[model samples]
Target chain A: MAALNIEQIALDIASPLAEEPGALLPILHALQEHFAYIPTEVVPGVAQLLNLSRAEVHGVISFYDWFQAEPSGASTLYICRAESCQAMGSAAVEAAAKQHLGIDYHQTSDDGRITLQPIYCLGNCACSPAVMLDEKLYSRVSAESLVAMLDNLPERES
Target chain B: MSVRVYVPSDSTALSLGADDIARGLGEIDLDIEIIRNGSRGLCWLEPLLEIDSPEGRLGFANVTAKELSTLFSDGVPGSAHPRCLGLTEELPYLKQQRRLTSARIGLMKPCSLDDYRAQGGFTGLTKALEMSCEEIVACVTDSGLRGRGGAAFPTGIKWQTVLSAEGDKKYIVCNADEGDSGTYVDRLIMECDPYTLIEGIIIASLAVNADEGYIYCRAEYPLALERLQQAIELATDAGYLKHFKLQVRKAAGAYICGEETSLLESLEGKRGQVRFRPPLPAIEGLFGKPTVVNNVISLASIPGILAGGAASYQAYGSGRSRGTLTVQLAGNIKRGGLVEVPFGLSLRQLLEDFGGGTASGRPIKAVQAGGPLGAYIPPALFDTPLDYEAFKAIGAMVGHGGLVVFDDSADLGQMARFAMEFCAVESCGKCTPCRIGSVRGVEVIDRIHQGEQVEENRILLRDLCQTMIDGSLCALGGMAPFPVLSVMEHFPDEL
Candidate 1:
């Protein structure tokens, strides 16, 4: 199949949802899901298609922490920094992860394999200091356990 | 008889590795059918494997993948495997309380319509189907059921406003944006019993004369969102729901959106900044139409209230606080999980009897009742009951019924600072007091901690907190001072 254009992809994903009230958020979500993150290149096109100003679209994208402006790396690592995790010493877990991955929150590794982010709560408070590496949720993660989990992540498909 | 086994598929259970155990069971050559059910709220014992016997559900605690075959070979139910936790219902922690809103969690499949209907699933909706909107509203009002999402406002009163309000189109929105650190009750209901929520929303739509509804769940809870979306689709497909239209809208990581107005703003695909009151969401809510925005727990509890009469549901609790509360114990607690009890039960009982005290084996120095915005209660005041009025009487609100415990190892200064920092990070920038007071609050606490003008800083912190309390536009700014003040009152040395 010929490669689909990014503008076409944005239009194809957003057209059906544009009619819904407050359709921008849903459209952004669909675009992010297909592209792994919102593409800045499609911002102007999305604005034109949705009848929103480019600034308004950008403001919405920037307001929510989930809507990253660039394409994601191979995977994203989320470390819980809320009170429950702090009680169980998430600082240590976070430290170990940063040391292991050689990256901090919002920073991709030098080779671009992983992007780290700080999530407030994943509702896994029962298992304090929870971290979601890729799609898996690991509980009661000590520094050592988090490192092991991070290391176990499979290589990203090129 | 073919033996059946259940493994929880909730986030906590999955985090503790339930899927691997199920896969391990799947590999075994046995007639036993494996069912992926929601957590029984016995979180500490997950992945708690349950077997169906002639008696009831027998449980096994923390079963690993390797132990699956051995557990079955040792004769699962009657045989005394070391991992056996006995009949799950009889377990002292689960048996000592009520499970009104959470009755169906852990017992059945998370999204199975057949299982849901078989286990009295739409009974309340079926009953509600025959009632008038006025009668439905009256039943909720009589139930004395308040919102479980921190605010403790009367659910019936909020609905009454929307029901009576003159608007072109009314909407029912479920605030599933449960971002509080210690609370997961909303996520539990959505994940464990999605049908309950679906039924509850439909009933709400019926009572309010709303033909459209939305469940604005946080993107934080992917599993809950996925299940709720699937449940809505399933309910729609099965013709269990028709008159009302329902949809699950995903919230993009905004903690302030948990506030109903901010949530409405976010739902409109705008910045999740707080909107002013008087023209409450009930009057001019989503898209400026009359809307009823209820928390996940408050709405989810409706089906049971309707099916079992308001008084029967109101039989629990004392004073103004009626009905059972689903208290989620987090932080350093040993028996960390969800406990549904009456409102009058004290934090002492929940912390000791249900939670089994701190996991670190140290005496719990403090407990943050409610969420980040809630006050920190020292051990001296452990006897304070879980009533909304009772908590407020002692300068704390039972906000969302989440008690996050902290042992002796915790640094109150850091905890205090973090509370301010959390407010600062999530303040939505709508008002000045929260947006600026929080950052200054953190600096003042730091100065006090560093022994620089300690006395002056303490005074300044107190002054700032009072300003945030009195002047802020929304609760995010208004209630953020509770934790700061609690730290100052109880742990003077730290501040």
Candidate 2:
């Protein structure tokens, strides 16, 4: 959350990775890791670095659910919407979270605390109704547990 | 010697708060060696604390932070606590299994070369190194090990094609983009026993004469990715990797990329789209080189085949569907976890014996065999034995051995809608039937569900499904209709 040198960061991440075969994904992933979002400005630079058209870069970012064009909320809440989770009553889990957060899937909360997304599966099917708070996964999650998990979040410093 | 304790580091255990258990144990003033091992695939009892004793690894199920105080009350060796499952290997769930590919999972430090070697890991590589490429291929051929990721294609034949394919630069690609709702075997291998997969890949490279290899893993699997990175470095440093250079490529989150051709496209750093076959990935794939694109299980099975001899592996299962199938039981089931059984195990027995019936304590209505694209089989056909041909006979395919159970409360009508919706959301948009037809299928299912010209919509939906099944370029478009059609067929009253 400091003032970032976007160009410098992009070049530092993209330069070495772009040398590898099929380098575009790793570069994009690294850039996303450095800064939570892929900046619109960096796409052209990445395209130039990878020797791909801007359209191609944009297309890949748009296609995969992982890459984002703008900054996401501090915490991303991914609820599994696939069949196994559905069987375990994830519909109720999704409804409760959406209601509690006052936001829908693909929407960031107004306070910029949480952004919600629907993931197909987290590969924790046996413990169904899985939810991921960013990189950490939580399984056997109920609506009550999710709301509690979401409520305990400390607000981000501006 | 200090008492050894195992706390699983696999994604499932972590999700269920295995980290907390590890932390709790850290605070305890006991002379214990806390080892972060992988899960026993006994997920229902996850956060399962195992302690080494004169008997064996004694399991403590669903251990809370508060439970740790009492855990060591009787001393270093585990006690007969109320929750203690004595002799973990002798537990009915485990004793019943015929573990092969996943034999080492949940047993040792995943990235530790020493632990892996101690457990007879590198013998496969040593054996593979001794055999010629043709001999290895022949051994696999005789084993009759089909692709575990569903297609049931003979693994030996696929390798033979790539082996003979005219290309100096052949590539070995491991498809670890496991997005299926009910499957976790791939994730387990990548996160828990990563070196096994690495060994499998190295053996594959030797068999096909490929210098470079890539594991096309999903970015969703953060732990698996991290573990794999560590495992690769450890294997490389130990010189087990030899000249075969390996790298992990994070998949751009697309369900279609789980398909081999689309995966190759994604690895090329492009939008994942279905490519037409005939030039098959075996001949011209991944930068137009002869590539052997295999599922994690398909590759992981190779080491065992080489080390144990093909006939030993082939002896387990019936017919052409030889060797053990890593059946992942999930959804509304009691005892849901990984069961590595031979091919001909009865589906009903798998559910009732291994699964111990529905967790909801309700009548089981249907089970979705395979991933999202598989058919929803009714309980009437639960007696069906698990085989490629047997499942196919019932208008189903044992795609990836993922059996997601559902109780009586589940609405087949709504699930039929979701199958199309999932397709619409994840479709690569290459073919019209998949891209356009999925959207239409969702609409038609909605219309039918709403009772808006239900009969007309039903007919229309069937026609649409037929078109998608017949005309689509890839399995994503072609097979999305399978679930819907199966639902309509089995639960006739629902839709």
Candidate 3:
């Protein structure tokens, strides 16, 4: 992947919206929404704009699991692995996804289309075997349905 | 006519395909306004739906897009489906809750300022801004409010400490790093009623005379982080958070940072490790200045206390443990969700009445209240009222109002092992008793589980637990052994 122009992007987004007392979170959210991940190069710029140190900006970004500094794949998949999901055959679904994708947890697909991640719980114990694909959530997912769902995704060419 | 529909923003509701229902409804292109709200805690028939009419909010249960049109055609105020629990307010579980901090939850659109204001949002802050810092502290003291973060320290005294401390650069730190398993109340409050917490934090900052505040939330809650970020923006724009310089910081899944001192270190961009206290956080914290580190619920309760006045707040609960308790009912339970009740409710009532017993359709053997560090109580002790003193008498601490139930299938010995293992993984390695003791405790418990020198192993494990409890620096190491020891004492048959 080519290097991102983080400084330019930060400048475009920076304003009074980025400097409020609760500004750090919204600024971080906007940054992630626009860039998918908080760019390391823009850390200083964000810090300067918010009157926070680069360390503070980096610390806040790194502390929350939602903020990612690295580039992400096209889509993110969060498979539930909590006790409730575990009881309802999520383990089987997880195994199948791993086999089908041929990738480990937190790793992106070779074609950079999908990234698989593990989530503790989705609060859908009754449905069991839940998975979140991008912003959309799926429930009562069987191993068979998981594969079919993946295969149905729009194909991407390198 | 503006037709109103409600879909839950609760994680459990989303897990049960509420998102699909919402999306499906959105796709219909109808002349209706669909609002996503929080859970009403009726977990059995989740993805509960509500329709707003000129009269009142109509309720539905386990609703799907396929049934929406038929339900609309019926013209019923509430669902007649077998799953429907009738009027939501009339539900036994919801009716019993005190709901001080959670008053607005599941009732309003999460991001709508108008919805929040309608539910009496910012009223406490508006009232608080009229009082001096001393008056605020006195009000909290009069309310008899204590820390809900397990320690049960008096909230008023904590604020007074910070207020009395000699420092211009004091800080208020909100500990939103809810790492304890089976607890999600903080996440729920942060997501559904984000402005309440923000308002509470701002009030706290003002009382402590702090120019800046920070909310350190864990990384696991992506939805919560998004909502909190949005709330912060809205609050700041409205000049609420601007009244004091308050910020929200996110923790990168480090369980150890739930301990106040370690949380401070993580905020300073270091590894989330615990620090020794002679200088408790109230004296020197967050960049070597006095800081008030409190849990989310503790901070969130401040607005209600300020608005209601200390005496009115104090009038609800039993001796010492005053105000409402926001209990996160989770684990092997039929109706697991957040429920806030006054301090005097019994454990049995919370588990059986609100939680609806075991979720697995098995008999409940034990319950662990107050997070991982809390003691495991047998079913026989269920009648005990959930107050700090009552729990203390029974050798339990209400760490955070997390009640994790377990069915008969649960092995106490294995659970003990998990407690030790959790400590071993989360220990900041700052103290020997926690770092080294937890690993040894796990090994000893494993030996007992393997049936090797059972009595000897039991005695050794007990000794190890005592040592860790006494010698550890912070609650991380200090209270790690509580659950393990409690399980061993109460459920020897499982061993």
Candidate 4:
């Protein structure tokens, strides 16, 4: 993928949402959806469009864990590490995940194939030990199944 | 007559490969009409395939793509297959319970407004349109409906405050940020029966006379967000939403944002920090205007109260907790799924009878009620009635009605440490007790577990928890101690 100018894309995203009340979050969402992270160069443009200070825009970005300042890896897998999953031995599953990928939570793989992150819950508590890859949620996820999935992932971001 | 088969598109069912089963069924040469419906909340029974048999809706559990071909080789509902679960309702896990808020979930096609109507969906809103705002509020108040989002505050009183509050720009906000570890009814309702929620929201708008409403759903639930957006459009195009303008707001990752005030802040595009209470949201909220903030269950229960009237809905349950509680059985349980029952059922019944014991075939040791913040009820207290007041008396909460069962293998000390760790990670960092105390808590538990200054650390942990209980701004800090204290009190040896 070609790296487009962040300013133009930010303007296009922020301009339309600027008129709406509480448009900052929506604009942030759109930007993240487009670029997979909020580019630092577009902060000023977002601030200007929303009639806010650069500090305010940056604060919002930094406050939300979902808003990444840096680009993510090829694929992201959010493993549930909350109370429910813990009861069903997510600790073991998490350990397996770390061992298999050789990466901790919030860390991307050396090959840039995956980024492991901790999610509180996926509401699939019945199945327990849930994991979300992109938009789809998988329940009762064993380390074996997860490894099989990791093995099939693309090598790097295009 | 044409044969119809129902399969759940609920994320839980999907995760268990319901899509593959559905696709395999479609590829078969049989003349079957497949309808993707919402989960019946019987999650352990997913991919719970149902076919409209002449007798009833015959059900099957754990049906795989390969099983789909063999199971349906005869091309009918009850073909004497090993997977057949007889009538769906006859299954004890699904039957022997009350379903009020989710009455129409698995029975109808999720996005079909027509199917929603056929199942008595818009009756509540229609009734609300006929009655005065005071009348609607009176009905809800009399029904004894409380917020199912852990707090258990009366829903009618909140709505009444919003109604009487003098704000020209009053708003109704649905707290769909279901961050609780074992809770998913809100997402289920929004995904399966979106119209019911839409109808309920419309009723709330009519009752409060608020022209605008927002459903602040978490970003984790993409399908729910998509379905609600579609439902809003459909309801609008159908003229059911003419009275109110409803929009869905996607919330970024923050467990604290599930708190009403924190949710308001996040909705306004700010950091999700809990606001100090004086002017409650009912009096002054949401852009400095009076707002009615309610859980998805609270709002969804409105239509039922409106349609059935207060007295009928009030008949279920015991003590102060009225109406049916949508108890989610999760974690290491065997038949884990959604079970909506009256408030007075025993935890033993839920855990043993409906849940069908542990998945690992080990004896059950502990069960965490009411999400991550709830207490760990020991086996000795399993016989306790599942009531808010009853659980409260025992130092537990029915928080969001999520019960995560743990087998004997679980380490109670590790669980205690995890509660603090979760609080440390998710704390908004606005207050001292929650922000600083949580980190200290993890260290204290670690010391206790390591037998380093065990007695002294135990005393220190008790005092620290008390300080957090009294000084913290919200439940995140206040109730984080519940699990730790309970495990310490009930299962002292483990800790």
Judged by DockQ, which candidate is best? 2
Q: In candidate 2 chain B, where is summed lDDT lowest over 10 consecutive residues?
A: B71-80
lDDT per model vs. reference: 0.89, 0.91, 0.78, 0.89
Model 3: which residue pairs collide?
A63-B251, A63-B252, A65-B219, A123-B12, B150-B399
Q: Model 2, residue A82: what's the lDDT? A: 96
Model 3: residue B192 alpha-carbon error in angstroms:
0.8
lDDT of 1 by residue, B365-411 (tens): 99998888998899999998889898999999898888888999999
Q: Give every collision pair in model 4.
A: B370-B399
Candidate 1 — which residues are off by over 4 angstroms? A1-4, B75-79
What is the Cα-based lDDT of residue B231 in candidate 1?
89
- How close is every model to the real structure, measured as TM-score? 0.98, 0.98, 0.84, 0.98
Root-mean-square deviation of each candidate, in angstroms?
1.5, 1.5, 4.7, 1.5
Quality class of the docking in candidate 4, CAPRI style: high
* Off by more than 4 A, model 2: A1-5, B77-79
iRMSD values, candidates in order: 0.8, 0.7, 4.8, 0.8
lDDT of 1 at B400: 87
lDDT of 2 by residue, B1-495 (tens): 778999998999988778888898888888889999988899999988899988789988887777777766677545556667788999999999999999999999888888998989988989988899999889989999898877888988989999999997999999999988899999999988898898889988888899999999998899999999988988888877778899999886788899999999899999999899979999999899999988999999988889999989999986668999999999999989999999899999999999998889998999999999999999999989999999989888899989999999999989989999999999999999999999999999988888899899899999999999999998888999999999999998999
